[model samples]
Target: MSAREEVLARLRAALAGAPPVVPAPGPVPRRQGDRPPGRPELVELLRQRLVDYRAEVHRAAGADVAGTVAAILAAAGARTLVVPAGLPADWRPGTVEVVVDEDLPAARLAGLDAVLTAAAVAVAETGTIVLDAGADQGRRALSLLPDLHVCVVRPAQVVGIVPEALDRLTPGRPLTWISGPSATSDIELSRVEGVHGPRRLHVVLTDG
Candidate 1:
């Protein structure tokens, strides 16, 4: 017999009476929804599911986005904010104790009130905000250290599904996927939010 046949004969001798392998079952397709999910329908479904996660979402168009971001920070009572090095000047909030990414020391981050950033893409289907540390988005540390985070995302940047979001993100670079606030459930079944990351997450969607 050939070497391959010899190997197979030895294996069969070791467990000659064993049953053939059986494949495991997978999740069944649900009939929960009446219709299939198209891109437009997926976006809407994503929006609704994100709301179910208790995320606050805002929308604005064109030049109004700047003013909207400023208002969001103001309403949240945020004073110190980490701004990206390459963020658009017009997107900045006026008169907030702005701290640039480079200027922020790692040790003092716990005291920071909030962080303002942009996203690589917003996956509506999963209610996820993706970060690739690009010009618009800042270092991953800035998002992690602060208690509250405000993300500015353009409507055109919103994709219908996770695969589409993956295409926009960088391969080896730092990627942060945030879905709602940082939360965990206790053994007693009580839920607590914001333990490891930001306590609150607010997303501002600008359409231009």
Candidate 2:
């Protein structure tokens, strides 16, 4: 037989004894009561996990968010800041120049010192924060290009695990899952930070 015919016959023979394929079942919806841990516990877990992941964590009450944000920026020595159009005006400090306009070029964004925004949900177990391109969160580029990112996460937005966080997210939106500052290791295992994203990640956990 020809080479092509031989190959086809062998493939058919291998599949001939296989059982019929079955479609996988779809995901079942979880009940509302399929809850995570209590708010305080989850928040604490998230704080620990994020710290372990090498991210800076801070706690604040809703009324104190502005002051906390200001302190973080000042400590980082950020001269210029950017925020999404829908970001709460009070979240920014009056000391630095704030830019809230849209359609900023990548070059311009890369020149900024830091970007600040809120998160959609955070996974405590995984130390991850999900940004679903929400108004406060802005576009993915806003979070990626900057050298520093300060994300404000409310206690109520913390989930126990990844699946729980995924269930809360809308799949259609652009989702950015951040665990820590971007880092990659070379073949020799020398770690280099900020290869792809922010070099520094700061999480401000606020109670609303």
Candidate 3:
């Protein structure tokens, strides 16, 4: 018999007496609450880790985010700012040359100094901003191409852990998890930013 035929015969013989292959049921993993114990000062821990992730985190009360954001953008010498469609009007000021998303050309996006938006969730442990491509945040390109990014996250939207944030995010669809500015290390150990995404990422935690 040919090699294929021999293999088939062996497979048939091996399975001939074997019980129908059945998947063994395993115990399901319990949720976070059922796991081991660890108590932490979430706010402080989150801030500490965010620093480690190379992200700049600013904390302010909810209402003050707009002013703080405006100041930050201005300080960066940013002239053109891209605002999402559904973003709250007060999240940014009226004076700035606000650029809205509406089939913006490559030249406009390239010239934009910063792109600002509200995040779906922020993982404090990893300094990650979750964007669901929602109206408040445009397609993945808007945030990725900009030189600087200003993401406004609410206190309640900030999770103390990564798994918690994963639970909050949906599995399907275009999800962008930004830890910090795009960076890479060369063989010589030289570091580069703005290679694939933003060179600087500034986060504003607005108390929800």
lDDT-sorted candidate list, best first:
2, 3, 1
* lDDT digits (tens) for residues 1-208 of candidate 2: 9999999999999889886577666887754334554388888989999988789999988888778878988998998988999898888878788988497999999999999999999988889999999999999899888899999998889888777887789999999999989988875897666777999999999877
On residues 1-208, what C-alpha lDDT tens digit does candidate 1 reach at each position?
Answer: 9999999999998778776586555786643333332344555655676666766777766677668777877888888877789888777777588777885787677688888888887877678888999877878888888888888876667676676777667799999898888888874877676678888888876655
Could you tell me how far off, in angstroms, the CA of residue 191 lies in candidate 3 after the best superposition?
A: 5.3
Greater-lDDT candidate between 1 and 3? 3
Candidate 1, pairs of clashing residues: none
Clashing pairs for predicted structure model 2, backbone only? none
- How badly does each model clash, as a count of residue pairs? 0, 0, 0
**Winning model by TM-score:** 2
Q: Candidates' TM-scores?
A: 0.76, 0.83, 0.78
Q: Give the distance in Å from residue 60's predicted Cα in candidate 1 to where it truly belongs.
A: 1.9
